[model samples]
Target: MPAITPEQRVLDNLRDTLQAYVAGDVAATAVVTVFRGQAPALALPEAFQRVLDELLRRLEMADVFSQDSCSFSSTGIQEQLGVWLDKAEARVSARTA
Candidate 1:
């Protein structure tokens, strides 16, 4: 069995955090608790951080668009995150490969 790397751990944490956030636990405390003491262990490259920041910004923009369209839905946001994750995962794979 291969050992899990720090990137794997952080990615798993991110998926879990996104799930919890979508499942009505959207609170600052919940988010902080998810990353606190967990995220600092990784020494991810700056490119990876930019990928994450892009995900965040994309989601924020999606939320604003939803508000403007009057079609706000958590599931829509989750789907947006899913697309962002696919893109980010591809970026990471390309970087690592």
Candidate 2:
């Protein structure tokens, strides 16, 4: 396999985080919690962080979009995350398979 670009790495990290959430991995949950707490101070490359941030925002919006009333809720967020993770995992699996 070719080396993963920085942008790809950011996407992969996001995907992995979501996968961990879907799989109910405690470690992943803890990591995410910590990351969220520290996200404001974490010094990441501008381009990489920009893409990741945009992706996250889009995912959050998608969560609200999935609701019948177009409102956001914890349930909507979880559902959206699940759907996004599933699709991402499938894409990764296809690439590797």
Candidate 3:
């Protein structure tokens, strides 16, 4: 088996973190921290990072307010994160190939 690259490792961790958050096994802050902490290692495009930052910001906002009080939708943010992961995985695969 080919060895996994650092970017792939970070992406895997992000996936796990996202899953944990969705399962309510983890907190939003922990998920955000994992994303930010692993971002540099991924070295993804600036555009990707910008979107990620926005999602993280929205996630934090959602976490702050109760569901009834918050306009921000945690479900929407989670869906966006899933899309981001899909694209990131494709990009990394292409880059490493």
User: Which run of 10 residues does model 3 get worst, by summed lDDT?
Assistant: 66-75
Q: Write the per-residue lDDT of candidate 3 for residues 2-96, one digit (tens) a residue.
A: 89888888899999999999999999999999999987677789999999999999999999995326888998899899999999999889988
The segments of candidate 2 whose C-alpha lies over 4 angstroms from its true place after superposition are 1-3, 27-75, 79-97
Pairs with steric clashes in candidate 2: none
Candidate 2 vs 3: which has more lDDT:
3
TM-score of 2: 0.35
Q: Write the per-residue lDDT of candidate 2 for residues 18-97, one digit (tens) a residue.
A: 66655657343343453344433334446434544454555445444652345445344555555544554455456555
- Could you say which candidate leads in TM-score? 3
Question: Candidate 3: lDDT over CA atoms?
Answer: 0.90
Clashing pairs in 3: none
